[model samples]
Target: MAAVEIAPTVNPVTKAKKPSFQIEWASSSSEVKEAQRLRYKVFAEEMGANLSQNAEGLDIDEFDAYCDHLLIRDQDTLKVVGTYRVLPPHKAQEIGRLYSDAEFDLSRLDHLRPKLVELGRSCVHQDYRSGAVIMALWSGLAQYMQKNGYEIMLGCASIPMADGGHFAASLYNSLNSDQMAPTEFHAFPRLPLPLDKLNGGLEVDAPPLIKGYLKLGAKICSSPAWDPDFNTADLLTMLRLSDINPRYAKHFLGL
Candidate 1:
């Protein structure tokens, strides 16, 4: 696929260009490397993840070669500020499976596989954690899904386990009752979070990303998975294009 780059236009009222942020698909190996470096800084330096490729200061994995990376760059600084890596079905097939397959059993989702895309390694630079950066990333994703005829978006949205997973359990307890997907779409975790042992009653605040997913009508596909390497509990999240909130879908797709 060819790279897609979008830049904001100047506002006529102020006669000045907006603080620019552009979204694009990583077009070359170097661009992908830049995304990896950003991921490393966020995941390792900030989140304390002991990344496998720490030697290069990059959070790279085997799946990167088969994924199309969406990047949000600060046009003024010319630096990648946010990124989301996507693996379309064809590319996932080439690699034998999606990245989420490593953490969960996806056999039950076979029916949706044809129209599904795996989204992973999502992170934003600390300086650009404002809502605008995330909105830019989502806008790009909406365009990618529509352009490629994809219907289902799948990914693991993580909750930090720093508090021994009380917050993760609490978040799951709150959402599972209403947002759990249908039985056929449920996935089983290889290393499941021990919900019974955790304090699910605590009114812990959900992570901003997870909360955003809920607002967009995403479903929690199953219980949280314990990822030792990343030191987080990951919940399987899925969003069907048809189920997106009408206002958001229209705004994101410009319809």
Candidate 2:
């Protein structure tokens, strides 16, 4: 009888591990590059932001070198999926001004600079839009500010103007008086969105991201600035640790 032909025993193929996420501060140039590349992907390619990107596909600027980058990575894949660059008061001073200063007159914020941090270039990988990534990023930000004794945060929250600015115009118009920052804290837009000329009556809601900020006690600091390069109407938003909504403060800061 011919010897029975037997196949070698096969080992089961293992599947990739997933669903693990971790927050970290970028500690090196290479790590910062990873965050910048993700920003390029989301801002330039996905959102059509006219960014002055390097050939390395990184959304870099003068501020990047002076900022601390908070990154959220899929631990299983070791991929940087979300990032927010933060410029602390000292760094913002070193950089001459916050990034938002180009579009808005931030003189009103000068008095708060000693305890302020400017957050910018916030973006997440398209695959990680389930709210978890952003929350994780915000958690990291809260911890960062707490650790450093920073009391205030400010940034430009961008609203899409794909409808030739109507949605942004309408959203600005729709905000009640209380939703705005106190007059003393308000920044003036250098190139304001033409709210008067645009249709400001569309039945619209604030974008989810802005809504999230508002929920966390972020106040819109001024009229929206028209960003030609990104085609966004940007609202300068400010958040003070003391101002965080009680419900969210408990969740985000245990206060």
Candidate 3:
């Protein structure tokens, strides 16, 4: 996309242009830094995830160099309000693994590596948590996939463990067989959530991002992994391009 200003995302309900924001790929190191700064703000400062303290206040890791940064900015202020990092298959191979590989044994997904793209560190600024920002992110993602011919989207979707994981345990316990990936695609968590120790019968609603993934045909790959640093239960999520919901196909993929 060459740092191009993409088409204004339309509000599905209102059919009005969201002129307050612009979405684009990070074409420069400074642009990527902006996205990283937002990640630090959301993950470290707001959510209190145990990220290493940095002088520049950026959330960074070894994988950042191998991934492409996607940014959604406030047009008025030019602040990156929403961000997602994408690891293409080639880059993942160069990096030797997808980030999810650290948390889960993804041996079963070996056959699909050539077709997989990893999405991670997804976050929207607290003030922009309204529906539109997320939708705009999706629009940018779908366009990326459509142009690149990627087949699968993979990532770890986190569930807060504020209640010591009862909600995550219950949510995993509540999935139907159909909502789970086939056994051949199942990933085993290295540090699994202690489902047996938690109350798994609580009625819990999935976080909005997770619910949206499920609606768009993402499947749970296996049991949740307990991410101590993030203080959340991480579900390895897989979404096949072929399985995208028809309703979202048009809005996201422009099919």
lDDT of 1 by residue, 47-96 (tens): 99878866678988899999999999887888999999999999988888
What is candidate 3's lDDT per residue for 1-255, written digit by digit as tens? 744354555767876663776888998899889999999999989888999988999999999999988899887888899999999999999989999999999999999999989999999999999777888888888888889999899999999888899999999999999789999999999999988899999998889999999999999998999999999999999999888999998878777
Among all candidates shown, the one with the greatest lDDT = 3
Off by over 4 Å in 1: 1-13
lDDT of model 1 at position 116: 95
Question: Per-residue alpha-carbon lDDT of model 2 for 1-255, expressed as tens digits?
Answer: 111111222445855444467788988899999999999999899999999867799898889999999888886688999899999999888878889989999897889988899999898899988677777788888888888899999999999888889999999888888779999999999999999899999999887689999988889999999999888999999999998999888767878
Q: Clashes in each model (backbone N, CA, C under 3 Å)?
A: 0, 0, 0
lDDT of 1: 0.88
Candidate 3 wrong stretches, greater than 4 Å: 2-18
TM-score of each: 0.94, 0.91, 0.94
As for TM-score, the candidate ahead, 1 or 2, is 1
